[model samples]
Target: MVQSGNQNKRETDGGTSLESYTVRDPERFALNLARALEEAGKAAAAWSRPREAGEKPDTMAEPLADMVKTFSKLTEYWMSDPARALEAQTRLFSSYMGIWANSIRRMSGEPAEGEPVEPEAGDKRFQDPDWATHAFFDFLKQAYLVTSRWASDLVENAEGLDEQSRHKARFYVRQVSEALSPTNFIMTNPQLLRETFESDGENLVRGMRMLAEDIAAGKGELRLRQSDYSKFELGRNLATTPGKVVARSDLAEIIQYAPASQTVLRRPLLIVPPWINKFYVLDLNPERSFIRWAVEQGHTVFVVSWVNPDERHGNKGWDEYFREGIEFGLDTIAERTGERQVNVLGYCVGGTLLAASLALMAQETDDRIASATLLTTQVDFTHAGDLKVFADEEQVEAIDRAMKEKGYLEGSRMATAFNMLRARDLIWPYVVNNYLRGRDPLPFDLLYWNADSTRMAAANHSYYLRNCYLENNLAKGRATLCGKRLSLAEVKVPVYNLATIEDHIAPAKSVFTGSRLFGGPVEFVLAGSGHIAGVVNPPGLNKYQHWIGGALGESLEGWLETAQAAAGSWWPHWQAWIEKLDDTRVPARKLDRRKKMLGEAPGEYVRARV
Candidate 1:
């Protein structure tokens, strides 16, 4: 029995010895080397002939093929890990140098103007697939070849590497080489490539100097341009509708815009834009501007521009926003226009506030408002989407802490947050492309507009996040505004609500759900595309999708009963609905102003940096 036990222990020890063997089998190594050599010979033979007769392969193909051969050779050169340190250090230095060079190019904006940056497609120098899809692929090809040679050398020298370590090192080397490939350069550094080409290789230093000079010149020009209201003159036939500064409130300085065009509506129109951003989003350039479009549409247009918040207004809350911002602006428009009942168009957040104002007006029997049109507005907060993520207690508190220190939330901070939501699509892809590819991205006006941003008052942001998003009281008919328990059900005026299907901020379902809360006739429209484009969408540019509901009788149930379905851009449909309310075509009279002129068109507050 002792002899048998000793024999068993010897057998077990023998098995363990085989497992613990560190050296690779000589025969296996020889066989792998032979196979690799055979493959390389075959590849060389294949390379000698054309894949297609008289058609040349890309310049990168040969280098890439050679790199592949080198990689295969590396797999067979297994050696101790520590013995490969010098080779590894050399590769590391090369990689570090490459990265440093790329960084310098980015900081200085060097590569863009100096050369024909290669296509990003098939480039490995970039980290993102989008960057790889750009036009700078050739630059990536060159970078890859050099990186591959260095990596292959590192793999060839070694002494103590086990199978696992060798395999891991080989794989990582291949990956890193592929990532840094000249072909991949476009993909890796798309932003750099794009910017380089676009700017014609203008360095950052030169660009900054030019920018400073231009800004200084612009400032001087602007100072001379800005004077008395009457002294200022517009270059184009732009807006025949003379605008007069009517009233100045705590938060907004109201201006009544009266167009000289033929009128198709009896009641005057008052445009209420959200205070969250500068009101000029509606009054942008003459062609695409909604305000300009309204004037061309022969409607009596009036816009209320809000006073941007600063340190002095840090403590102002929602109550102040309502009483001072909304009510004050409305009264001024009413007084200046002499129109007892004005048709109101409230866009985005301003629409919600407009609804609240209507409820307040109903309570006070205020007959100034005739009809209300809400564009891309949300009263329901149950599904406000990602914006609600910031509504959590912890996040909100953190934001408040940051805002408290700054007095107001920075516009750049807001822009950064929204940009992060689509970092790959909106931000990072361009960065990698321009910085890595040594090119310039396409300059898009819409992108430029999207880039422009403004800050939100800390007090307003806090209250809005808490009351509307977290508590969700607005849709519940329990929201209090200006010391009144505002109820959507109490609003009996004709209501027109426009929504978009792909709106990231306000989903259509949320907007539709709140339809039940309104007591009067409700027309809910679900437009195609996203929040901004859908609202600004004009006919013939793109087709829009929407659903229409019949007029809501006095009861909410009655509205749901007649709520029929339809489809198309709600603009025309909305136009028809609004047309029905006008009754007669009344000539637009010039609006009257009570207060003396203070500043220019698009008041100083609108121009103020938040």
Candidate 2:
């Protein structure tokens, strides 16, 4: 099992053995209260400001107004449906009373009816032995659960808010509730108390130091334990696959892997990974490297390593990415391999760009692309998942202004937004371990790669938000790139699409919608796991399963119903499909150099920090 410095300690008495139960520094609480009051006063002043004639309104104003209107309607509904409200109140009261009665019975050494209450599977706060036997702790835990359940029910039953508004409201309510949990405070958490007693309050001092260091490291608001970059060096332990940088441009570097097989497919494979992250994710370690796997499968593999943008690239737009990134990658691959046609695979945002490029290529009657594969990509952003919360007009405008000032969106800023989506898993765990409990975060390869994000150009990011997220022009056939209007329907190449069931960034259903937009023969695969896991799924791990079906017709539900379940990674299936596309095998050709070879694989561009 993985070890943690802040793991809970067991007491000899079978109860929490703490020398002190109260906080040692009461002045800290006072300071916190004063800070909160000052912030509240500032907010009140800001709220009182009058709107300018043509100035845009505050982004939060509409949501706050909707919440007020929702509460008003809820009040009326509660009055109209007295019985329902009464029943809800009665249930809440009964739940509290039941906890109290159980506590009393346990205190008196009497057996209570049924089993004692246990925390939910995801809740690790009450896992301490004290909560199981201590009457006060047990009661507190039960009370919190009952109240949390009541609040959730109230939000679920609330009326007047549209689906989007309700979702936002629920998400915010969850954040508030999570923040108020007892585990976050030193007084209530057994782990914190235990650490304090064991370290004689040194743990808290160290925690404060750590917090200061984090703030100094430019993560004050995000509260994440910054990954130590020195631990994992690129092209050493991380991106270790042997390859050569065959071509370079302002936007990307093309890495062509050395062939593992005696003969390879005539048509080379070109991979387009998202520019928001380094390309090493696909070429991580030899065992988990999809690039290595494809090379082993006897297909010549080529991947695009996107440049981490800076001020110099602030003016680059989607048109530039298409012209200098994807198009350039394809041309370089064809030129090096001396092949007229190539198979292409795009992952996440790269897939979106690839689809747009294909549409433009089709419009111009360019038929170089033989087949297309999109991994966890969304072309139709109508239901683009939780990330849409950050794509609103006001939020986008604010981001645009920030990008204008900085020349690009900072990597840390984008990472923070993504972490908020799964805060419990990605954010709070680090806060508790690194700040509250004074423990260092475990070294995780995926998390390290995730933290190593890249910045986006200001013009490109703004256009992406407005055109893709805000207006959804690509699906409607109105998106223009490089002076050409493009549509997904115009692309007639054979397509293979993959979506993960639990992907929060690109919802499977949204991905499913893209399959319908294709006019050519399409194969849709549904893998089990989140966005990264599903895409990086290697064979023989037996970690997750995937589903495949015939053409996805008009409905996602119908496609799922007719899909066939498979017990292994979808990589083998993808290989089978690729093999069928081309049967002519030729001897593997070595890189001829001829001024095309730039350097070794996992080149210098990926190492450029934002």
Candidate 3:
């Protein structure tokens, strides 16, 4: 069990125990406030810098910087109560000066050099008396509402506290109450606040100063906005993995990775990657890459790198994706590897396509697939969580309208929606650190990977939303792919279902339910971490923990009740499972090149860039 911060503190005779509460470190809070204030100063200096000295400053920065400066000065006043209120008076002076200066600029409609300035519709400082009154009244309304709620809750909760605890609580509550008066909130939030105040008070200023120093020293440089392309390189093992132009009706290109000197195994492994992102996610880096590990374990790996969609592919639907994506790729992998049966691994949306292909293959009696592995994929969308929030008719209509204007769904827009689902962690935290703190966010490899996005054909996305997410037809066995009824129950091959316990996107229960949708022998494994981290989990790391239970027949809840602790990564466990199904103990056999002439490996379709 994870320990609470005050775990060591014992309970007292009073109703409130010290162990039950955790106090914020005053010193740390003060230090953080100081850092934030420093940052505010640097931001102010940056705003004041001449256009030639600094790249043209953002028009938004000047007002925000001006408010931040006022907030800092106010904080300086608070540092020593009754210090003649000298800094407080100066802060008031700066705030009014900023307001009047902005007013003059608005009246003139131009800068000193006759340069035209952008009009501010939301600017609070207007010469019109009515405008200022309305803004101030609205600000006071929100502030009073918040202040009343906070005060009431504190009073109600404090009634049960002991003398000592109650006194501390009262002090904190009073401090908060005084801080919320229309004057304080504005002082704290500054630009948005009714008055000039720090967003995080002193901490924001101090952090900003440190960040400014780092930037000056070429360490933590801030980027106000994000870029479309990422700097990360896609790692490669095959020399012929680069894309080349291909003609219509050409055989799909295949990239194979595995160890040398092994006979063609009976079960070749095929990987289906989501077109929403690049195929490199499976082969991210040598250390954590699933493809690299699979090849090293002596399995012939074949991955399909999808063509990034464009206006020309707008008419392409799920039917086309199945034909060119799975069916064609399967045929190519089989013919090249000389294998009668193969193992397939599907990820996210790719898993949905794979399920459809498997149904089609089964209907045709293809006998090429020996087993199938799905990673955090859903066959049932009934309990899909937040993704369900976006599946309504109105939402679908809105999507259709937007897609009609643009042939393909913009990749960045889709990324934005996904990121919004976890705004606090995914968006705001980074915004505060990078923009407000003046520091560059830590470079996370997974986030870098997520940054790499690709467009989806309009038809493909529409069909997926209607059939898979909204209708929930796939799990119900009412879905049809390529005009053929596709049933999950029919694609009954040895299956491996892996889900992360803490996965927000695809919960373990949802993944577990997907197993019941199939009539195959299933092994459901639960891993640690979220969707991405759980998959890319590498071995040999200390403090890494995961729980494992019995295969499909066992209840997941029952297993969790008696689950055993396992050391190291679950990769070895997966490797063992794959080995048991291997009829041939030998390595993979090399395939003849240029059998069908898919132009070249990778293909131009996969290389299309924004």
Candidate 4:
């Protein structure tokens, strides 16, 4: 009964036409509508089911609601005029088919009409010659890329969802599309396929064995290939710098490195590393060791080695880290070095604690802190980066509940979260290499230290999440520590702040913003690479570069625009700055035998495993 002219015209126009396929039969359209609704209902029921403990609650509810509204509108259009509904369905199919056809044409040596589909700059999987030479594989790669773009466009344009919800939708969609890439699959991946055939299908058998081994290891997910944990021992190869633990507490130990210079700065240096990981990250390998480098620069260095906390230490709070950790270390350094004032440095979360400790010290008119250096630390949570996605009230509460059950946050859990942020680089490579290729993981010093994680006390972690992240209390000067209200503005010591350009954990912008919060003259430096690499960068390698601004500006953009790029490491620059502040040079002093010595350089606490 309906006119077939539009349908024929659309078909004749090829896949480029946006006209819907005309449904000549009304009953058929009604039946399709019923089937779609039935499937949606089933999906809704499944989504509503109770989730397992520690599982992240679904964030797709709003997006799913928007989808349901779209479907309902389409259903109404079908009921009113089945022909229009058919046209809508046809238009959607044609759009997708057109995309595939264009990809095919490009793969077949036909020039593409618009800009060519290019892989993301960082994605190098398709850079191989086979991907370009082989038409079939090239088509697969192009098709997947085009599909991902189309999906992203749809999510970006979707209506009825809030900004945050839309962001969540886009992120999840990207993750899903990336996971489904042809390069990830054995059959579609040219390299993997060739390797499989060359190995006579032995790779598949080995992959199966590798997967079973991972499961048996009780990690429940494949992370890395079987690593020889014994090869990279602490205090031997890594964290091998010559030092001695002079003081010990339940929370931390102060290690005083033997000076490498004839004359050292009269004021000693105390390093406070994040309790989230072992302290030896600063002292890892003599060549790349920051502590050793400082000692060589004629600055007596002392590091706080935090205890790998357990259920018994679950009740420890931020106060303990300040009173028994930073303050205690400062006291020990002053006692051993006979220096009334000591230069202080803090890394990541340790910087946050140091900032609070300085504020507390200022409140009581304590003048022990001569200067402070903050490395890749964020006191302001306003722009804390992608990690903010997990800082929502619901997510934080869920984390708290999980931590309560275990009495502490498991290191493996935190590692997994950090890995997810860079899954393409950190996670999936291991998946393909360890499982698909069935190869053992190569031993790397950095990866070995990264694998050695530490648990966080529940009370301390919860307070940090609530006050620092969720509430933005620290930046607002509302954060309370050590039974005193602390303010960064009150701590008026000279401050040197370092931020990494590619750091995801503590974004450079966030760090820069926090640097401005200090009441004193602040020197903010932007380094290349990520969090760890930026801090551990040495002079000789001349690998990544850094940027230094002449003057601290009000905005990060303005500062970056005025900054100048420098070759080599930022270590020398930092050393020069600290030396300028410290004019008192005295002969290097030996450790007093009267002081109680805890143990050797990489203390017993550093050896504790999660």
Best by TM-score: 2
lDDT for each residue of candidate 1 in 1-610, tens digit (9 for 90 to 100)? 1123334334211122211112134454355445544544543444434434433223334334543554455544533355455566666676645645654564454553343333346433344343323222323443555557666566545455554344435544654554444332322343433343333334232333333332243331101111122322222222223465566777877766657576646676778888776666665456546776666566767777777777777888778877887677667666655567778989888887888788878888887788899887878887565566445565567678767975777665566555544443554444433333323446544554454456778898787777787787887767787788888888999999887777767776666666667778877766778877778765545466665664533543354467654554466677678778875676766553344665546565665652
Q: Give the C-alpha lDDT of model 1.
A: 0.59
Question: What digit string (tens of lDDT, one per residue) describes model 4 on residues 75-173?
Answer: 453456677556655655665576567667755658656554678888977875656655556667777887787667655655555555555555566
Off by over 4 Å in 4: 1-99, 102-115, 158-163, 219-230
By the lDDT metric, which is better: model 3 or model 4?
4
TM-score of 3: 0.62
Candidate number that wins on lDDT, 2 or 3? 2
Q: How do all models score by TM-score?
A: 0.60, 0.86, 0.62, 0.83
Q: Which stretches of candidate 3 lie over 4 Å from their true place?
A: 1-231, 235-253, 258-264, 551-556, 587-607
For candidate 4, the per-residue lDDT at 151 reads: 64
Please provide, for model 2 over 450-507, each residue's C-alpha lDDT reduced to its tens digit, 9 standing for 90 to 100: 8887898998899889988889999999999899998788899999999999998999
Worst 10 residues of 3 by lDDT: 190-199
Residue-by-residue lDDT tens digits, candidate 3, 1-610: 1225556354322222333223244455467666666666775565445444654333334323433443344344345455545554564455445544554554455332332222235322222222232333323433344444544444344333443333333333433344343422223232322111222234355446644553443222332223222344444332233332222322124566534435545677888877787776666565667776676666777777777777878888888887876776667666666667788888878887887778878888887878888888888886665566556565676676667666777776566556655553565545544444444556555676576668878998998888877798888888888788888888778787787877767777777778787767777777887777787777745335566665454456865666676865677777777778874755556544454445544455455564
TM-score-best of 2 and 3: 2
Q: RMSD per prediction, one decimal?
A: 22.3, 6.4, 18.3, 10.9
Identify the candidate with maximal lDDT: 2
The TM-score between candidate 1 and the true structure equals 0.60
By lDDT rank, best first, the candidates go 2, 4, 3, 1
